[model samples]
Target chain A: DTAVSQTPKYLVTQMGNDKSIKCEQNLGHDTMYWYKQDSKKFLKIMFSYNNKELIINETVPNRFSPKSPDKAHLNLHINSLELGDSAVYFCASSEVRGGAKDRGSEQYFGPGTRLTVT
Target chain B: DQQVKQNSPSLSVQEGRISILNCDYTNSMFDYFLWYKKYPAEGPTFLISISSIKDKNEDGRFTVFLNKSAKHLSLHIVPSQPGDSAVYFCAASDLGNYGQNFVFGPGTRLSVLP
Candidate 1:
């Protein structure tokens, strides 16, 4: 069974177009995250949600928004997509077991979504 | 600024040999370090991690070494097989941040020749 999964594995759209990517996890985890991997293979965290609450919002542009309808799903919506928006997006989940300040927060990742904005 | 860095961009090793990947971080606040392996067209998978309090941690053929004084960490894979060839990423997180707010380093691609 796939622990984490993403929809629309590949997205290609023209400039100024809007797009969205969906992510889901079945690992019974409490926290979910969205990350962007640039052309240079530098992976950075963009957003993080715990139990449907926004916890970490990075210095990302306002064009990108993330919505978590439930604990198991976090979807990303990009507005007015530009050339720089072209990159791979990844979803990950980690459990907060036995409290202890969320120690050993090992994350499980889903297959990435490759986005291309012309 | 890049808090985490992996100086090596790529490395090649023969099968059954040991592969070492290095990573450094400028943030002294970082207490947790992790290594991830990624294959083409897939997201990264967690391999091993070590905390600042410990100098080394081992699991099977994978081991992580942490040097808090230098703020450096390394991942060693013994008897590397072709299947182990992939892009390895080093990530760090501080206790003050929310759970696992990892700062990732630019990845290093490894090629294991059989």
Candidate 2:
């Protein structure tokens, strides 16, 4: 079974269009995160949700919004997508909010969604 | 500023040889360090990790070493295989921040040749 999964493995859209990427985790984790990997392969956290509560919001553009309907799902919605937004977006999940002594805090990653904004 | 850095952009090693990837961090509050492996079109997978209090942690063929005083860490793979070719990422987190803020290095690509 897939521990973590994201919809739209590949996305191509025009600039100024709105798009959404959905993610789900079956690991029963309490925290889920959204990360963007640029062409340079630099992975940076964009948003983090713990038990459906927004926790970490990086300096991402206001056009980017993340909504968590439950502990198992976190969806990212981007408005007015820009060409600079062309990159891979990843969804991750962990068991706890804080550092777990056993490193069970390790984030389980999805296969990643490659978004291309024209 | 980039808090975590992997100075070497790429490294090549022969199969059956040892592979060592180095990483450095400037944030003193980072209490946990981890190494991840990634292939093209896939997200990173956790490999190993070491706590600030411990200098070394080993798991089978992979070993992670942390030098708290030097603010450095390294991942060593024994008997490297061709399948080991992938990008490696070094990440650090401050436990005080609930581990929410993890800074990752740009990454180091390892090419293991037969």
Tens digits of lDDT, candidate 2, A47-114: 98889999899999999999999899999999999999999999999867355543535788999999
The TM-score obtained for chain B by all candidates, in the order given, is 0.96, 0.98
Q: Interface RMSD of every candidate?
A: 2.7, 2.3
Individual DockQ of the candidates? 0.55, 0.59
Could you tell me which residue pairs clash in candidate 1? none
Candidate 1, DockQ to 2 decimals? 0.55
Candidate 1 lDDT over residue span B4-112, tens digit each: 9999999999999999999999998788788999999999999988877689999999999988888899999998999999999999987566656889999999999
Best by TM-score: 2
* Model 1 iRMSD vs. native: 2.7
Badly placed stretches (over 4 Å) of model 2 are A97-104
